[model samples]
Target chain A: MKLLEDRIRRDGRILGTEVLKVDSFLNHQIDPELMAAIGKEFARLFADKKIDKILTVESSGIAPAVFTGLSLHVPVVFARKNKSLTLPDDVWTADVYSFTKEITNHIMIDHRFLVAGESILLIDDFLANGQAIEGLLSITQQAEAEVVGVGIVIEKTFQKGRQLLDGLGVEVESLARITSFDEGKVSFLS
Target chain B: MKLLEDRIRRDGRILGTEVLKVDSFLNHQIDPELMAAIGKEFARLFADKKIDKILTVESSGIAPAVFTGLSLHVPVVFARKNKSLTLPDDVWTADVYSFTKEITNHIMIDHRFLVAGESILLIDDFLANGQAIEGLLSITQQAEAEVVGVGIVIEKTFQKGRQLLDGLGVEVESLARITSFDEGKVSFLS
Candidate 1:
């Protein structure tokens, strides 16, 4: 977590009051070495949980989730995002509204991947509004799977996302927790 | 490569004639261990090339590209797929047509990641119609970056993808090459 926080301080770009762009290393252009270390850290954090598989959304989440899956020795399933409201058959689906993009996407996972009673650990790049994680949790519930915990790469603590997850009583762990963006700079939650 | 071939032989599902669904390991439901092995294989295959970065499309390509980036000690940049034709500023973009999905996607890479004269290794999950790689190549060209080689997880030799890459004079290495899907069974190009 220190490494991640340090990297965020060094490379993260602050946009307006609440936006943090880590495209240089975390999301768009990825640092695989850092991802491997993050994977190890997540593995250590969730060492006690019985995780059958790791679940995440497509694109950004796949990198961290796969590395964590390697460290945890589990399979990873990424929920695909479909912009249309018309849901596909034979898949566990949930609608996620992204405040940044200002659009609602129907995220889905093929029913063949997740099974009943399977233990899943959700992973994502950033926990802003928690809409993405909420969608994953919805699909997990639909499949009758158990969520052991949620692992986030970067979390905005000032946002409503953390509070929402806390209300659900889900154990959430983020490598870097941002308290605020003061004077166009990142302020980590100590 | 043998490990991957064996995995496909055992787990890959054959649809009708030409389609091979490898959702269990390669794409949707990913096995990180296998992906690690794949990363190592790609590293070995491209060991001679002076690769400054690894490039691939988002979602499915991130897993293998990150693993390969870890092994190669380089950064991985995934091109984002934008459905809308409206191009964003300050990014290198290319249009790709997916034969399977029958849709055209404009893939974009941030200009900050790729630099002129930088050597890049293009990585992807599958090589069917080569449109994805073609798009990446186009973007690389736009950035004036040199593509050293291409690493593909699975290649359908019968498809036009292989021939297209061959025509472009790009060095391509596929871990598992499928000659045909005869009688709903996979046949390796060995």
Candidate 2:
């Protein structure tokens, strides 16, 4: 976690007040070494949990999810952003509103992949408004699967995402939590 | 390569005459152990090339790209399907037509991540009509980066993807090459 926080502090860019761009090593461009370390941390945190599968959304979440899946020695199921022709007939879907894109899109996972009573861990790159996490949780519920926990690489703590998840009583672990970004200077929480 | 070919023969699904779905292990749900093996295989194939980065499209390609990047100890840069606020101002973009989706969409990569003259290895989950690979190649060319080679997990030999790449003189290595899939029986070309 210290390594992730340090990397964020060094490479993360503060765009205005509400946005943090980590394209250099987190999202768009991935540092596989750092990602492996982060994956190890998540695996260490949830080592005791019975995680049958790792779930995440498309694009950004795929990197960390793959690493976490590797560490946990489980299969990673990524929800596709759009319904492709190749998708199976039976699927569990939820509408997620993207604050960054300002559009509502459906994320889906084939029902055949997630079984009933399976334990799943959700992973993602960023948690801002918690909409994406909420959608993933909805899909898990639909499948009758148990969400063991949520692992996030970077979290915007100043936002209500953590509060929302806390209200739901879900255990959330974040590598780096942003406390504030005032005048382009970033601060960490705790 | 035998391991991958066996996986495709065992788990891959043939949908009509056009689509071959490997959702069980390749795309929607990923087997990390198999992916690690694939990463090792890719490393073996491209051992001679000095690859500075691994480039691929988002979603499915991220998993294998992550593993490949881990083996090579390099960064993995994934081109995002949609333009988000987090994306940098300057970008190298390309239009990719999805054979399955029946629509053309643009993929973008941040200009800062790809440096000119850097050797990159393009990796993907599938190579159908070669449109996605062509799009990735276009983005790399726009950034003035040298594409050392292209690696695909599964290649449909019946399609024109390989021919297109062969025309370009790009060294392509597919773990499993599909010769045909008729009456639910899949045949491998290599």
- Choose the strongest candidate by lDDT: 1
Top candidate when judged by DockQ against the true structure: 1
Cα lDDT of model 1 by residue, A1-190, tens digit: 8999899889989889988999999889999999999999999999999999999998899989999999999999999999875777999999999998888899999999999999999999999989999999999999999999999999999888898889877678999999999898788888
Residue pairs with backbone overlap in model 2: none
For B1-190, candidate 1 gives per-residue lDDT tens digits of: 9999999999999988889999999889999999999999999988988999999998889999999999999999999999876777999999999888888999999999999999999999999988999899999999999999999999999988898889877689999999999888899987
Which of the CAPRI classes, incorrect, acceptable, medium or high, describes model 1? high
lDDT of each: 0.93, 0.89
* Cα deviation of A183, candidate 1, in Å: 0.8
Off by over 4 Å in 1: none
Residue-level lDDT tens digits of model 2 in B1-190: 8898888778888899868889999889999889989998999999998999999998889889989999999999998886433545698988888878777778998889888999999999998899999999999998999999999998889899999899887688998888888878888885
TM-score of chain A, all candidates: 0.98, 0.95
What is every candidate's alpha-carbon RMSD to the true fold?
A: 0.9, 2.3
Interface RMSD of each: 0.5, 0.8
